[model samples]
Target: MNKQPQGNIFHTPEMFRVFDQTKGHKSTLWAVVDNDNCPLALLLPVHVTLMNGLLRQLTTRAIAYGSILSVPGTAGQTALALLLQTYKREAKGTALFTELRNLSDLGQPQTLLNDNGFAYEGHLNYLINLNRPAEELLQSIGQRTRKKIRKGLRDGFVQMSEATTLAELEHWYEILQKTYSNAQVPLADRSLFMAAFNELYPKGMAKFLLAQVNGVTAACSIELPYKNVIYGWYGGSDRAYSDYLPNEMLIWHILEWGANNGYGIYDFGGAGKPDEEYGVRDFKAKFGGDLVNFGRNVYVHNPSLLKLSKRGYEVYRRFFIR
Candidate 1:
């Protein structure tokens, strides 16, 4: 699957192991192979069950990051169609919905996806090219963002470094937990990140970076690096240090590190739906990356249940999130 152009970290064996070992996450793989047993197409979706008790069933959903990985042309499309059919049959009633997050252009296979019951939705993402000179990359940044980064560095208010120990990773995770808790959003358990650190960090498939202010961790980000692309997976900051622009510095540090290390692209994970008003999207846009609408394909097994689940989530957020 790594040989395929669209293959991403989420579709790899390493990530599958991360999800499988993580609490509340169930990883599944479906593939189409040739007579000689060569893989023609592959799909790896992880069912994430959040919250507890009855809410877990409602919030459980599958996410296929980077969508279907397949060979080019008609044969590949045929294989993908077959794989989708088999996967849909097995996935029915397993979750509220299965979302295929497309990282690259699916091209003609999108029709096959629609035919297989997945409906398309418009989504957006930012991609910063890292295969350029460090100066060129810096010059491309939006003027305002560049100023904030410069001011933070010039004043020595924030320091950026990669987390090198388990404790450091945990510290970073604490910031992420607080950020999600404040936003009333569901975050995966710490076991997921611990697994990634244990399994992927040593292999250079993962990186944990920290931004510190006055020797205290103020912001953090976890990046999944596969092939030539560094995917920005999770990140958050201590809002108390917002004046120091820790988030901006953290992102700049990642970009600089990637550009200096021969990485080709930094995928800004996601930018929310195009039709929605997302503050994070506006924040990400200031970093000077090309915005792309790769979109997403969703197959909801039970629409009425999904609606109920949405309402249940609102209650969960209002009462149980803290």
Candidate 2:
């Protein structure tokens, strides 16, 4: 745990400690403190092994925003520069590259990144303002979205919070697996989800919202509350109940819950690029939120190895893993 005033829950020691315990990802908290030993800036970099440690990469803490927090000024930039240099030196012989993925609207430190030889990776995200009145927020949503929520409610769908039982967790994981399989994408290991649910839910840092239809789980979403923002982390729906539109209902309920609980923002997580025609982005946009850009800042410490590792992973995915 790094000694600092508690601000963002994502930047907290308990969060990283849980990540270390459950996800098997090693995280190091780097900070620049003031004269009084108060942290002026902080960055959490996670170290991960690829291809069984044949290759390594230093990336921002998994499942959280990767922006160095500092007082509103050059302090952040200075700390970022120092952190980059430190990471470079530490990962010289170990990591192929280092990457930082910032939260939306947290603009990239272009000058510093450029000076440090970091490349820009653009992204888009949606943020639903929860400051407005609940009714006003509901009215702001697209008509189709509102209709879906209404239909789900009319159909007797109920929302459940924080699945505590193993059976519930297993059911949610099953839906997640199906969702990924249907999309033709590989599913992330279920352990990560379990770990978060087990560790953060009790502390009120995470919420697992489940939409049920006739006693059966129809849709579920995992949200993380950090500071005043509630992040829509991961979700999946039972395609069999798609007509009921449980997903729409789930999000609406989650938004209502967040608003009622005094959360100022509901982050729809990562959307695709602005120019891209992404269904996920379109779905998220219907809920009425601002689309913002704040993307990845990448630095290649060992370019040749990075390229080689990427190629090797692609080959492995195509021939073995996939």
Candidate 3:
């Protein structure tokens, strides 16, 4: 259980480490407001991944995964001031700012961060409320796309729960690896996915869904069901199944499964880059889901430092990511 201290908001390294694993960042720095005893507020740098040629980072309520919890009195601004007190103290340092992506207000750290010297970098987010009826939703889809989904249903693809055991996570892992291989992108640690899955499965917090053809796993998805909403967090499909419309069909099945199972909303997770809606935006719009402007945050030491940091990030990504 999470232990809360008296009045001080103490930050725990365990929480920050979890964020690091989920975000897949190379370097991270952490801070918390505490009276030297209990842990209250949580703060850490996410996406400290090499970007433009600088040490870039974003600090938020829970900078790990998508949604993280914070202490009752902790706020973004509160976390920022404490964070800045350390980084800013490093004399001759350039301004350091972070762009928090795909975050909506449920424990927002922005209001407080801005108070301490953070600034609104820009809007970065998307939300698919699982509160609408399937009929209302299907009616909104483009006629052509709707036909594809119907065709998928007519096909033999079926959804099955794949969270019966740790072995079940293996199937999901294979799908994730295939996705990365197809895109030539770096794959995150499978063990991390397992830890998350094992921890949340029983609580019904998340589940792994599979679509098979001839009993062979062709497509799979990892979804998180929390509160009244179900998030289509992660999933991948075989391109060969594209002809069968596996992606659309799998999603349709997920929606149907959620509705019948008592879930109200099905979040399609974030689309593309959090700030802009170009490609992924159009994709989600095809589902007839409404666009939601999500809140984001940026914390920096100052202007000069921020500029220098950007330059550093450019060089870093070029050497590391590219």
Candidate 4:
């Protein structure tokens, strides 16, 4: 019997570069290389912080996030499978679970994930095609949205500015904090956005935008460029200026910016479920983007630990965060 040849496996430096450029999540990258030393597949595992308790341990998740490059055809699947097996073997006593959020259009990844013991969790995302001319793109938006944009400009005295300094970041983050507080949702640490802006702005991978009313900041957004798509990562508006429609203007400005910059698509980030009546989804739908359902895929290494961690996190969210 002949033994199968083993390919080279190691972490690439580019992973660190990516880790710095996006949402400030602590991440490590792993890749499977071919015999010729070319990378066939890449995996990025992110560390998620859960509640800390002595017998109830929480797990870190490995997310694909923005980039999940792979070779064409089944070679990618083979590389991913091999990487998962290696990860499971090496990740003993480390993380309680692992997940891979596949790219929106990654052929058919569920088969490979299922074969590797991963369960599927469906999610909805909205994508705006930016290949068309700006005029056509504007015309495609809902009439009410267009009116709101115009109203924001004409009545609200809204002005859009590109943020370039830490002061601007602080302003954007303050607005974010208010927005999250108003909604009663738990916001991530401010350090995450700060780190992301500090790293990605210099690399030209991210943009922080602010919409002001009469020189007062009323709305803000963070746009990230990955591959050929621009993602509207985070956005918020002042409820005081709700009648002015600052958010509508902010979104329209983002779309125009994407078109002018030659980006092929504008991702509205994640929407809610298909049958759900979510205000966020309804707002995104007015922009004339397509709704996609390429959900998250999860693979658990230790079911018992994962269950305990989830229950603990739920309690934390309900009592402490809320």
lDDT of 1 at 307: 97
Tens digit per residue, CA lDDT, model 4, 1-322: 0111111011224435545444434677677899998778767776554433554246354555643556666887789789877877886556676766544665555577677777777778888999888878988899988767766656758889988988888888999888877776667677767766766777776789999988999999888875567778788889998877788888998898889889888988889667777898988999998889877667777888777777776666677663
Q: Which of the numbered candidates is closest to the native, going by highest lDDT?
A: 1
Runs of candidate 3 with Cα error greater than 4 angstroms are 1-99, 106-112, 115-117, 123-126, 158-163, 273-278, 300-322
Q: After superposition, how far is residue 114 of candidate 4 from its true place, in Å?
A: 1.7
Error of 4 at 95 (Å): 3.1
Task: Give the per-residue lDDT digits (tens) of candidate 3, residues 9-51.
Answer: 1123443343345644432544454676443344444443323
- The best candidate by TM-score is 1
Tens-place lDDT digits, model 1, residues 1-322: 6577787888888889999999999999889999988888888889888865867778899988768888898878889989998888887888999999999888988888999889999999999999999879988999988977877778987987888898888888899999999888888899999999988999999989899999998999999888999999999989998988889988998899899999999999999999899999999999899999989999998899899988988887899898
Whole-model lDDT, model 1: 0.89
What residue runs in model 2 are displaced by over 4 Å at the alpha carbon? 1-7, 53-64, 74-76, 107-110, 158-161, 315-322
For candidate 1, give the lDDT of residue 173. Answer: 89
TM-score for all models, in order of appearance: 0.97, 0.86, 0.67, 0.86
What TM-score number comes out for model 4? 0.86
List per-prediction Cα lDDT, in the order shown: 0.89, 0.71, 0.56, 0.72
- Of 1 and 2, the candidate ranking higher by lDDT: 1
**Please, what are the lDDT tens digits per residue for candidate 2 over residues 14-80?**
6676556544456667777778886666777665543343233422122224555654467766776
Which residue segments of model 1 deviate by more than 4 Å? 51-56
Lowest summed lDDT across 10 adjacent residues in model 4 is found at 1-10
Poorest 10 consecutive residues by lDDT, candidate 3: 1-10
Runs in model 4 deviating more than 4 A are 1-25, 51-56
Clashes of 4: 0
TM-score for model 3? 0.67
